[model samples]
Target: MRRSIAVCTLALVTAVGCGKTEPTTPAAPASGSTSAAKPMHPAAATAMQFLQASAAGDLSKATGLLTPVAVEQLNKQGMTIAPLNVESPKFIMTRFLVTEENEAAVEFAMQFQIEGEQQEFHGCCVMKNIGADWRLAGVIIDPGNGMEPVVQNYEQELSPPTTNPANTVANPAGGQVPQTAQSPDVPQQR
Candidate 1:
């Protein structure tokens, strides 16, 4: 009887621990001073939410929590996808390399499977305190690979530079031009 009780108890605990949803409380309205000045232990909950969202391919909900720029960039790619047949995630965040930063960012590292392939995805999420609300700001994906974000050379994958046209070219010293139509066309230079 005691063994049966123990088995039941263990099963209950496992069920509760595995499929948990974080309570989403709408953050207070944006009042410059009253915002929660910090995010705590978000690595675990946040990671879980991400996995749930990804597994379900809930793009609309997931994108809402992400930076507009990232969404645009991905959509530009042919990867408008929500992979299926993925199993529920087993939260391994407690084993992740997590670091708490200021009120805006938290760093996390974890190993997980995607498409049955295992890879470690670690990144810094830049959160913004907007109107007493703590919404995700942006995420810089870091694989801990020490390599910069991979820039795919595919034409369909490229987005035209968002950089200001005038800012991209370097000006010569003394602000003199080599007679190229570049920057020299500006009457201000004449």
Candidate 2:
């Protein structure tokens, strides 16, 4: 009887032990998944949002993401940004440099198709942490196509000077006939 009781007790202990549950952590969501809308970094999220907004032709949304200085610079340059027809925009976060506790530079690569043309651009976005939010301070894009921002070439000749009769200065000779044409201004040396 004692042996049976001991066996039952062992069985109960084994059953209880077998029925015990172990703690588990949920798996992390895949990157870029909407259901898990968490981004790897704040600047990355901002950049991606800006690109998406621009691609969707949401100028208001896109401009809203830019810093005040960026908007002013764009305005100063008279830039007319056409809506991009981007497909499958991918953002790859690269090196991130923290200049200070509140400022950081995020480098990233963007790949997408614009008007059916495949395009890739590398750029950096300077971000400033503002009261628990990350704001884009500036953006620099390098298309890596040996192209640069269009600049007015002041060295290039504009146009031939227009002949303005009203602005023309009077001849210093003051209506005097040229020496070759008539008598010299001063007596010619014999």
Candidate 3:
């Protein structure tokens, strides 16, 4: 009797398991149909595409995204315009300012490791819309130290004028001290 009960339980479990069906995956879209993907902004799309091509070591495709002036500048600098041999290349968008309806300025930072040493590079690209396509108008690469002097000069230019020699006061030693150096609240000792 016990053996018959055990066989009956085993048969019931097998029957229940066999009644279940596997889940099916959704079918892929047709080859030419990209209707499911979201579209990107023209400037951002072009810039990202250029960076991806460069990272993939496709020099021709990358250069094709640049404007004629940019290509000429690269040639003038004697640069090979090839993909940099970097490990773990990262592109970061810092700013995207639209100056006009069809013009924009894009600032980005790139970080990567070369020869095991990590480095960061900053650049700004001007993009212009030509017909329905966005293309690079110009590119400026910074060595990370180029803006210091410019900022310093601008600050100096904006600062108020320094002590004028015409407002000098004679000290005990008959030396002239600019009025700015002495506090007006304190009387000078003759």
Q: Which stretches in model 3 have alpha-carbon errors above 4 Å?
A: 1-40, 68-82, 145-190
After superposing candidate 2, which stretches have Cα over 4 Å from the reference? 1-38, 68-82, 114-118, 149-190
Evaluated at residue 146, the lDDT of candidate 2 is: 62
Off by over 4 Å in 1: 1-52, 66-103, 114-117, 150-190
- Candidate 3 lDDT for residue 164: 51
Residues 71-181 of candidate 1 have per-residue lDDT tens digits of: 565677755424323444332321222112222333334355788887654443344333443334333344445555422211124455653545333754455654565
Per-residue alpha-carbon lDDT of candidate 2 for residues 1-190, written as tens digits (9 for 90 to 100):
2222233223323322222212222222222335444335665566566656766788888777766555665566656344656655766555555555665555556677767888766665555566776666555566566654221111122233454534434442455543454465667765
> Against the true structure, candidate 3 has what lDDT?
0.52
Clashes of 2: 0
Question: What's the number of clashes in each of the models?
Answer: 3, 0, 0
What do the candidate models score in CA lDDT, each in turn?
0.40, 0.51, 0.52
> Looking at candidate 1, what is the lDDT of residue 110?
39
- Which residue pairs does candidate 1 place in steric collision? 29-131, 30-131, 30-132
> What is the full ranking by TM-score, best candidate first?
2, 3, 1
lDDT digits (tens) for residues 122-184 of candidate 3: 655556677787776544455454342111111011333455534444432246544466788
